[model samples]
Target chain A: MQKNIAQGNLIPFVSVQQMVALIDSLGVEAFMTELAGYIEEDFKQWSLFDKSPRFASHSEVGVIELMPTSNGKAFSFKYVNGHPGNTRHGLQTVTAFGVLADVDTGYPVLLSEMTLLTALRTAATSALMAKYLAPEGADTMAMIGNGSQSEFQALAFKAMLGIRSLRLYDIEPAASRKLQRNLQDRGFDIVVCDSAQAAVEGARIITTCTADKRNATILTEQMVGSGVYINAIGGDCPGKTELDPLLLHRARVFVEYEPQTRIEGEIQQLAADFPVTEMWRVISGQADGRRAQDELLVFDGVGFAVEDFSALRYVYEKLSDNQGYDKLDMIADPDDPRDLFGMYLRLAPSRKGEAA
Target chain B: MQKNIAQGNLIPFVSVQQMVALIDSLGVEAFMTELAGYIEEDFKQWSLFDKSPRFASHSEVGVIELMPTSNGKAFSFKYVNGHPGNTRHGLQTVTAFGVLADVDTGYPVLLSEMTLLTALRTAATSALMAKYLAPEGADTMAMIGNGSQSEFQALAFKAMLGIRSLRLYDIEPAASRKLQRNLQDRGFDIVVCDSAQAAVEGARIITTCTADKRNATILTEQMVGSGVYINAIGGDCPGKTELDPLLLHRARVFVEYEPQTRIEGEIQQLAADFPVTEMWRVISGQADGRRAQDELLVFDGVGFAVEDFSALRYVYEKLSDNQGYDKLDMIADPDDPRDLFGMYLRLAPSRKGEAA
Candidate 1:
């Protein structure tokens, strides 16, 4: 349903159905590549952003967070929840939505369901970082924990870096089969492995994205070979770490935002004073990324808000050509801002018999 | 404009149009009075809540904030912006919307436009405080700053306190005239005064709700009488206050939450060690509200998140009988949860030609 444009209260909203349509219409591969470009561009200009760590409300089972950031011209925030047990009840472990607003007027311009968009952006960001930090001429990736995000990661790497090979592993074998089936005709040389070690064999890049809330060692130091790039994504909050501490000790770490990664990333397992480089510096040619040929590197990603800001910005731009969005009468634009009460009073007679 | 409910992905949304209709259908006075009951009840059980100071991002002309709270059962947050310059552009000075989610599942149950609801709840909270702190038989209220929130405050005081007389004043005479026109035939003896002092001449309760973003003293120490309840509503954020420092020093201050009020309320002008009482204690009969008939009292309302939570709760309950809402297809409720990618892939065929 659409609201009157003249009212100037309409906010364009992209729903899950519309998001899926948007992704399919653009095609997953092309969309991820374009999203990666936007992510890289935002990273290059990261100094212009007003960045802050996400504000989280932790519960016994999970957490819900508000991640907000802006670049003076536009403001965006993502409302996301992480409930690892949600998948057990036939729900996604992570579900999200975001809003993009005009910073000048403090008014929201776009609201979009970010569950699918988050998955796309997460993979796009990982690949964008890999483009700079990954091993030279890397053509194969080992995806450990083949859950909901596995397919997107596989496709993003393929689209962005021409990586046409995937070795998949999951604690639950059914999850591995699901990932394999989803990527069947997507032009990838796929292999289903029995263990994380087996998945990492003959692969130059290892991506770990488990859903466990505890500090579990999905990848040990011995399993991670040198000259490889590790995309550690699962250990996002405190008490959640995917890679062993010894592995991080031997690797040169890169992070999206240092302050947040120290608390919410795999680096949380290390000392507070542990060294890490911000990826924006490398992207902007302000710092060196990879020094040695066989030096191990880790991208400790906790999903920063700027990436979501870029994703929302991309969706807002796409609205001009996309029909998969609806207008929401979200803001109250009264004829006279002070006569807000009168707006209701005048509508009282017409709506008198409508209330049940 | 409602979506199919059987999908289990629908989130009920009440827009500004629907919210106005809902308030008018419920009858404004009755709605405000009932909302006050909810606010009082929530205050009585305040210890059961998880409260936090609002996280605000301030800009040159405005501030955007996310206020979140939970009761271990239901979680809610409000996305609101305060831009004093917005009125010049024909927009609301303060605009808002909120979401209510299940604590266990972390799924949003309802999303509603909160510009009108905020006006209603703020007035309800003020009136609730006045009911506890005002002198006995206080019928006349001097409403200084007759803006968007002024009429609601007047109506709420009339409904809750049986105050049948109102003396209104504003810097802009047109705003006072608008308020007077809106409140005519509402069973009140309305008097539009020329200045703030003339408005508060014989009133026992003085409400100052101006929208200036600076520390402008709307009420001076000399203008206030010895025994009067001050409803200070406008000076919420830092560098923005409506009352003179001497006035706060003379009045016994009461706050919704002490820590938050110390930074955002008029009390921000005073020393950090200044004593203030939380209103819940008075509502719970744990502390005295108004000490003496001749003693001054101030309800420094910064507008906490719990009131928004209560307002959202009220709207959620009313959704059962109200059709003035739409279902938002927000959550991506995949059947297997892990097959989120497959769900989108299947829709690809149907959305073949939709991409431009």
Candidate 2:
């Protein structure tokens, strides 16, 4: 699906299949390191982005969201959904796509499938959070959700934090086996644990990426050790939280965006006055990240638009080498500012012939 | 092209080409009538929507906006841009596209080009406003901007309001001539006037649908009479207004959403405390629209997301037989929730061979 139909214009799209291929080709470890770099670059000059809370529609069955962001030059938006019961019908619980457009022209430069990219970015964000929030010299992580995003999370920790070992646990044994098997040829060692307790027994960093979409305590207050960073990814919507309120009180919580976190992140379980820090401040060296080892920390990871912008940019850069057409004629070209009628003149005979 | 490859799924996107075809197929008059009906139905049940002011990013060249709305079940968002200078580069000055998605599943149900739809909906909105603002038996309209959208506006007035006569004016004679050419077969009594004053001479309804993204006063206080129903569609973004401040003071200004219109509509030039009524209130029969034949009324329409929702619904019904697809495998579907690794095995081997 690559075309170089136009000389100066190339609208490269990363489809779900292409994204999967990109991730599988590079392996998850390399993808995370590169993605984290992109995120870090954007976060350093974070104020330049026109950031707004995602517009969401919540129905009883699931939730749909639109997250958009712009840095004076380009605009990007992601369309995503979270339906927990989708797997029963052979559909993934969450699926997504996004668009990146030129701010000057408002023309979409890229349209990408973000389903796989979402997993990559989430893992990358977790690794970035661990760089600051996790205990010094953290080498191993307990992965609570050994499902769709488990592999990416495992490799991110391995590449970024030198986490040579992964203790994986899922509600279903097959999930743990699948994750353990995927890492068979990969460099990292994987341990299939029977329970959450077994997974976290000796792990320095605990990453809870479960998919229940409900308020469930995957990690109890006692199971958490001193200085461990918790990357809570699943409990992102209202009424969906992974940590016990007590655990949040003990840990210094960090969020992607505060307003969204208040409603969608694990912080939703806590009160309005719950103290939290934005991740960008820590990355930019403006705020205190970790005071001392053994201080509990939490990256209440509710995905943000900035992460999507980073992913769109990464995919656009990658696809440029392969080349794809601006095959999608997404806009009308009015030759004269006031003359839309002129556009129709050329369409007449040619279109009728094509239609026949 | 309308795709019907699949039996049940309809994929009749209003692509730039299809939009041009849509106009050419039914002519602009019929398009506007149906568009007005769509706008009216959504406005009638205004309480069902979760409405917010459009999210916008203004760069030096133009402004890009995302307008999102939902009615608990389905959510829709339109990505539109108003780059007034884009036409010089063989692109539309105002181009757009939007999507309708299931709120629960987050799957996009429709992705349609809105460049032509924007023209349709804007005209429909004006016609809808005329329904409430115009005095009974009003039949003549003065179309001030004879540009891209001028035909749609002209046709909407003719179809929706029984407006059979038009006094047309534009700085460029060619634009006015073009409008007359496309509209000749529709049988409206059209008079191409030399000036804006000449255009408004005896018309009962005055429409200013200009294209300039500046504060150009296309309509002044001296031109408009007491009883004229004014459709102010051009003055949408900040610094882009068509009506003079004096004319706004004299007229019973009506708006789609007062808070939004105050910032983006003709009312932007008026005082903060200026008296105005939301057109929805009038549609809901809660407010008095026209006090007498001599009372002035202005419908300030800056496009809304609900209208896009209505358009999506209308297009779905119109092209229920069309079908097309790109089977995006973005989400990981594991037979068992925990067996996500199996998907990697299934996808990777096949993909790598293809990559090689």
Candidate 3:
């Protein structure tokens, strides 16, 4: 049955089960570490990429966005939705899927469930940015809002930045416990804090990933100490923001894409002209990262298309030797390109027994 | 093995083979006729839909676009690519796939190969518009550029408007012969014309569905008679257009979406302020279609997201009783919505034997 599908029509599709199996095979931390490297490589040559602000369709409940980018060689886009109320109905607050296509032919080569991949890439990007912007010798991270992404963030930081200690806090203690339980045997010294204020006690790095659609300051001005690197992940849409504006004023903000970050990042609260460095420039050594030891730094990550592109590209390259992909008959490939109608006719029940 | 997968994780994926099978089972003309009804229903309630111009990424050779729209309940988007030069390499000039998601949950419910679906919907849309725009008792269609979409247009017009006579012409004589051969036994009088002039000689409806990426004058101003309804389908991207500008000036132009058609349709040659009636308005009876017998009508179809939405919705509804769809594990659904990490950990080799 599979042999009947032409080569051009078959796209490698990685399902959620396959993604889990693949991640388990490689180990989540190692997968993210490699994914981070792909991201860094792309960021180094970011000038070659075609970057556009994500196209978002907003509704009363949520927003669905399509983030597309290309580096002339490959094109990738992620279909993601953010509905904060989804968790209440036993659904994920955010779920995603993406496609990687060949730029030469505009043919999709891979389709993968990005719900898992998005978490991995977001964490990878946070850690990759921390490598440049975090205070030197940072060994502890204060993770606010320990939800689905907490363990991934913790592991990514551990893998990329050698952070062994974590202070976790969430509005619901069960969420923090869930994070702590998930990371318990993962070789980390964990502390479950009662409040956001208590979570940041001695940690040099602070990661806020609260999922609220409105502007609620997860970290205020007084909570953020000097020289502490803040990775703000959840304030990712128009009305959603995490850091206090004053905190943004005190910190040197870095973002994946300026135009997108201006609208979707924590810096959305700030002015249009508020100074922010594009992370690609810093990764490429064209700009500064951490200017001073006591300089407050914020990696305002709303998630960019390039990071997803990198993740998809990483998976596509790995699938050559990986066991977690299925060939999907997605593209229509008629023997005669102009004879699609003839191809349709040949698929009829009467014509099915005849040779092509 | 299928029982192990969660229900929320599975999306109904209609592949090319599946689409072909579904179309064949229903019969292409019947399927398109039903699809045309869906298109008309949506067009009637056009104000309820969220319409945005397609997000396109252009390469040197072609363009890849994402067309997204919603009607408050269901959201749909089509990922389509147009590479005119692809046929030279034995690939379709256009290939597409689309997804239909629930607006309330922001979870995808259907993923379908839209190369076949797109052809169907484009033809359906053309025919639907002609039902309103075409002259009374119009039976014959002069199909210039008899490529992949020619037979579809012919059958759709036949299914919807009783158009049984097709006058076909292509730059390549082989393409015209291929079209004629396919539709020969399908109960149509098909004329394989040598030139564009000969094709449109006496027909009341002139359909141009070429695959060039440039502004080609497939139909000159003098060739289009005063009483003809022109269905122009080829000029769908920036710098790609069909029909002479003077002919557009002479005709009362109707478009799928005015904003898109201004940039991509034959009207791209005209000023941005050039008058064109929105097809939805005509469908909804807010505007007149054919005011007089001799007044020229042009359905400047650049294709819109709503039409794809209608097609996807039609398929999704039909799949309830249809046999040609596979349950694909495309979305990640953890037992606990906030325990995605735990889900990943549980998938490990050590935890394989453990029961949930």
lDDT of 3 by residue, B1-356 (tens): 10111247788899988888789878889999999999999999999999887888888888888889999888899999888788788777788999998877788888999999999999999989999999999889999888888989999999999998999889989888888887877889988888999999889999998877688999989887788899998887778888899999988899988887888789989998889899899989899999998989999998889999999988888775335688888888888888898888777665697652
DockQ for the candidates, in order:
0.53, 0.45, 0.66
Write model 2 residue lDDT over A230-262, tens digit each, in one string.
888888877788888888999899998898899
Ranking by DockQ: 3, 1, 2
Residues A262-303, candidate 1, lDDT per residue (tens digit)?
A: 988999989999999999999999988878769899999988
Residue runs of model 2 more than 4 Å from their true location after superposition: A1-11, A85-91, A135-137, A245-252, A269-275, A287-296, A321-326, A348-356, B1-14, B135-139, B284-295, B323-345, B349-356
Model 1 DockQ vs. reference? 0.53
TM-score between model 2 and native: 0.89
Model 3: chain A TM-score against the true structure: 0.95
Q: Assess every candidate by TM-score.
A: 0.94, 0.89, 0.94
Sort the candidates on lDDT, descending order.
3, 1, 2
Error of 1 at A125 (Å): 0.8
Q: State which candidate, 1 or 2, has the greater TM-score.
A: 1
- Going through the candidates in order, what fraction of the true interface contacts does each contain? 0.65, 0.65, 0.75
Model 2 agreement with the true structure over B230-278: per-residue lDDT tens digits = 8888887888999889988888888888888889889888889999888
